[model samples]
Target: MGSIVLTHLKSAWHVDQAILDDEEKIVVLRFGKTTDAAVMAMDEHLSKIADRVQNFASIYVVDNKEVPDFNAMYELYDACTVMFFFRNKHILVDCGTGNNNKINFSIADKQDLIDIIEVVYRGARKGKGLVVSPKDYATQMKY
Candidate 1:
């Protein structure tokens, strides 16, 4: 005889606090305005815990003004400014554009579009929870 059992699987969404708390290194990609003050502030904060943080943490500022092709700015970092963070496993990406509302959507400027990159990066790194089929049939059948 063949029988089928169905179980409910709950998925939880959470920020990987460990990723930030235990991070030994942090890399920031500053484009557009490229604020030195912010960089200095972050550096100062990180320096306090430098002893506990054992990895290499550095900030790279890439001014979009220097780039010959503005459109290529997105491509500069894998179609997103935050890609560097993913590539280097950094905790955050501060693109110099203050907040989402501050961004000028009317313009396709690199600075304005940086937020899009940030959003995509945030979404990929911390996915929203959704109920889906389990990888193992036995686990699914048990619920």
Candidate 2:
């Protein structure tokens, strides 16, 4: 497991490492906030969850500077928000409001992360691209 810290909009966030290990893609847990305390709190919460999972993991914080070699799957253009990505695909989690300002996870537990890895890896093997929304894929169709 590896991790990286990045800064965005003057807020510091620690997120999961973006390394691919043993064919298992890394999970990126992003935390964004205007205040440092709130960001730290979110980090603590995610750390606790990661501890419980006992899976290979890393963490990072998002910032304004674009991370080299890192591809963005989704962008939460609002206040402090947390986002997770596996194998370049966004992990859709339910966080009540469904807004981009809060942390949400619908998959229940860490096992879900593992499941995402397996599914994404399998799809890649079959040359099946990740399923994205029609609007998001409109440009591809144009080609």
Candidate 3:
């Protein structure tokens, strides 16, 4: 139900506007299907912290199937991809997964997601296009 409440970007124009129009808060776009297991998990986590990080970030969900305009540009091939942007600049996150692009996995922990969002917001505000994630996702052992 969390995924149902979050704002969904339905077109290429909307996506572009979301990226371009936000001059202050960090824009977070989740690209994937809400029906997918991993995406559902990620969306749930994102929804939980939407309010906590509302001051610094704006979360929006984009269905890859609906908005295929960014498939090759941003590489929306993952089951779930979370990308960040600020002031029309794409903000990359080094998640230690060797992919300094977008987060292509589910982060189950709410606090962990919040921490990462905070880090991204802080870095973006400082005029940095990329920020290192608080958690080295590749190094952590997942149960």
Listed in order, each prediction's TM-score against the native is 0.25, 0.43, 0.95
Please give, for residues 1-143, the per-residue lDDT of candidate 3 as tens digits. Answer: 78876899999999999999989999999999778888888888999999999999999999998889999999888888999999998899999988888888768889999999999999999999889999889964322
Best by lDDT: 3
lDDT, model 3: 0.89
Q: Which pairs of residues have clashing backbones in candidate 3?
A: none
The residue-by-residue lDDT of candidate 2 on 68-131, one tens digit each, is 2222334544333455455544544332343422243233244444444344444444555442
lDDT of 2 at 35: 45
RMSD of each: 21.2, 10.1, 1.8
Global lDDT for candidate 2? 0.39
| 66 Cα displacement, candidate 2 (Å) | 8.8
Q: Give candidate 3's error at residue 6 in angstroms.
A: 0.8
**Ranking under TM-score, best-scoring first?**
3, 2, 1
Q: Model 1, range 50-122, lDDT digits (tens) per residue? A: 3332234333334344542432524433212322343334332223333211111122233323333434344
Off by over 4 Å in 3: 140-143
Candidate 2, residue 115: the lDDT equals 45
Where model 2 places Cα greater than 4 Å from the true spot, the runs are 1-26, 33-35, 54-57, 64-79, 100-143
Reference-based lDDT, each prediction? 0.30, 0.39, 0.89
